[model samples]
Target chain A: MKIAKDIKELKDAISKFSGSVGFVPTMGALHQGHLSLIQKARAENDNVVVSIFVNPTQFLPGEDLDKYPRREEADKKICEVAGVDILFMPEISSMYHSDEVKLKAPSYLGYILEGNRRPGHFDGVVQIVMKLLNLVQPDRAYFGKKDAQQLVILQKMAKDLFLPYEIVPVETVREDDGLALSSRNVYLSAEERERALSISRALKAASRLIMAGEFSSEVIEAKMSEIMKDIDVEYIAIVDRDFRPLKKVKIQNSIILVAAKVGKTRLIDNLWV
Target chain B: MKIAKDIKELKDAISKFSGSVGFVPTMGALHQGHLSLIQKARAENDNVVVSIFVNPTQFLPGEDLDKYPRREEADKKICEVAGVDILFMPEISSMYHSDEVKLKAPSYLGYILEGNRRPGHFDGVVQIVMKLLNLVQPDRAYFGKKDAQQLVILQKMAKDLFLPYEIVPVETVREDDGLALSSRNVYLSAEERERALSISRALKAASRLIMAGEFSSEVIEAKMSEIMKDIDVEYIAIVDRDFRPLKKVKIQNSIILVAAKVGKTRLIDNLWV
Candidate 1:
């Protein structure tokens, strides 16, 4: 696999491929979720490009930016094994400059769940993704559904901006214990790790409720809240595919989302019904 | 010139061209200035595309959005004469949606001078330009320096976002009377029209001052302000190419800008030294 550490190198690397290019953008510290995206990109396109940029703008002042995981050597090995044609690892300086254009997250859908907890987070996410998308000019970009809000917002932006690339969403990858894989998962202590399972369990409970003809949002949220009683539950929401609030669930269009703090490590999980 | 009234049509029209495209985005009411951009595009590229979008987002409330000039037939004739291959005139609904992602101007440079007078104006300008740029996918885009601040801000955005297009700056076109050609110039009464000449005259005076080796920005602005005394001078600024405030003229890198109101019509003019 070729490694491109700057924009100019990445552009030259991307220029060599005339066939369809599939891109997967990550923040390094590759997990099962990121690997799955890379594998899918490799299978789908003639050229696969992966970018590992832990965008600083996406993190709020108090967020875990400094402590974010960075296992670069391992990430490189995984990409090489996964048959990534090119891996773009750009420095922050090359990606951003002071007093340049920025993006604003959609006021309603963008600021409801994950955005509510961290205002302006998605704006940074959209901005960095735009920069990367333009630089890569991929035929299709892969994104894991683990960050559901991020995926939805990016899809909206790509469509709204009339970008040439397609946004292909892959399902979230999880551990055998039903814990959604996240880089933040490393921050959890031994006991805290066990406690994180409740998040997925709560989502599973919500899924079961939907299967049992429980369409009321309040009832499903109540059951999920009960499953996550021990953990610090931030919010349990039922929203449509567009992230608009749904008083009652709409099968095949609804998503049950949950956010909670397990020993100071915040995690999010969702189940599409 | 072929006219495309929606995005789908525009895309279809654009697909027929395989050679280098030079794009000129305008708000209709075509004047000599816009024609100059189109003529330049025609000369420079195999395909020339011009978009006539009023772009409502760029106009803040209480601004001249509703009353903005529109001369479709005249614009079409001018484009045809200028050898434009296509003219995209999408409806507002086709270009924007509610709860969509938007762009923000640089916090400092974006909010000074013209931005200070109409806050959030550049955000809309950047947003629409990004959309048009992506949709057209031109090899080079033409922009007149008459809107000097807008040109500078867009240059910053294109570079920061890594957009795959070259920004070709066109010289500002003026009338025989030295008045900058603008659609808004129509709003001026016959008497007001003559009074508006002060804007360009002041810019000319500033240029002459620079030629005579007067480097102090204060002295230059003071002389220009004296020339524009009859009108309500909004701002007279001397800044470098990047819009940074310059204490003294930097000769080759300086821009002297003036904005003022004549009989309720606002006009802007600038001189690049």
Candidate 2:
């Protein structure tokens, strides 16, 4: 496993590798969910490259940027075990310059849901993703469905910019108790961890209601919001595949999402029906 | 020369050509300036691609978009004589989609001079240029230094986006009367044509002043503005190569630019020292 700390080193490593390349970009603190993505890339492509960058621009002030989880040695071990060929770890200085032109996330789509909660978040995501995508030039990239909107926007970027690659979306990994896998999960204390499961529980309730012919978006959201009564819910939304809000859930085209603050830690969960 | 009307066709031509590609994007109505670019591209690159797109996004409402000069037959003849390998004539609809992500010119640099007078102009220019660049996939693209800010900003975009192509800047082609070549010059009547020479003459005067050890930017700008007294001068300013206003000319780093409305036609001209 080669470790590349800069773009030149990464490019040299990529040149050494022959055949198809698969890439996975992460914010470090790898868990089973990230490992799953790496493993899939390793299996599908002749070479797998994983980038661990804790992007500062994505986090607004007062957001958990400074304290965001970082397990460098463990992450390296995980990548090595998952058969990653190249591990790109860039410093903040190497990846960005002063007053550079940046990618702005499309205003209409990006200003809703997670984007609203973390304003300017996706713009930073798109900016870094664009840089990473161009540098890696992978045949396919792996993104976990845990960040559904991010995955969708990255897909849109690829298509919009005519980037030559494919986005392979792995299903969201979950804990036995139904809590979605997230690096932020480390922020939860025992009691907070228990309370955090309410997010998944609410999403499960929505899924069940949908399975039982409850297609009305308002009723499902109302029921989900009721179940999320223990926490400070930011939003309960039912959006179409394009993210436009719909009055009724159209099967195979709808996603029910919820965002809530569980003891000061924001948790988001959703199910596609 | 082969004619391409869509991305697929353009990329097809691009794929077959392995050597360096030189590109010139225009809005038809082939003039001496465009011919100069085509001739230079032909002389330098293994293949030459020219795009004639009367980009709608770049034109404001009531800005003569409908009556923009487009002499297709003459354009083809000019390119053929200039040895262009491929001529790409794309429809505006073919290049852009509804509700798409867009490029914004730098807020600080874009909203001055030409941008202030014609807001959103550079955004549209950057937007179309990006699409054309992507479609062309040229090893090197050419832009005349006449559109100095546009050229500089495009270079910034290429660097910011990690676009792996060189921006080859050619000199601005001018007439015997010192008027910079422009398609919009067609909109100038005979009297306005005589007045339009004021832009180039002011730029030349600024060049002469700076060369005579006049270091103060304010002094140089005042001299240039005085020369364009008859024209409705929008702005006469001195900026560094990065488009930031400079207090004093830093020899080789200073740029004196002038924009004026001569009759109904707006003209921009600049000199980089």
- Among the numbered candidates, top TM-score falls to 1
lDDT string, candidate 2, A1-273, tens digits:
999999899989899988999999999999999989998998899999999999998898898899898899999999988889999999998888666666777786777899988899988998888788778889899998778788878877666666667888898899999999988888789999987888898899988998899999989988888887888898888998778999999999988888888887888888887
The fnat scores of all predictions, in order, read 0.92, 0.34
TM-score of each: 0.97, 0.92
Candidate 2 positional error at B245, Å: 2.5
What is the C-alpha lDDT profile of model 1 across B115-193, one tens digit per residue? 9999989999999999999999999999999899999999999988888889999999999989999999999999999
**Model 1 bad stretches (over 4 Å):** none
Please provide TM-scores computed only on chain A for all of the candidate models, following their numbering.
0.98, 0.97
Model 2 segments more than 4 A misplaced: A222-229
Task: Give DockQ per model, in order.
Answer: 0.84, 0.46
lDDT score at residue B40, model 2, on the 0-100 scale: 84
In candidate 1 chain A, where is summed lDDT lowest over 10 consecutive residues?
A202-211
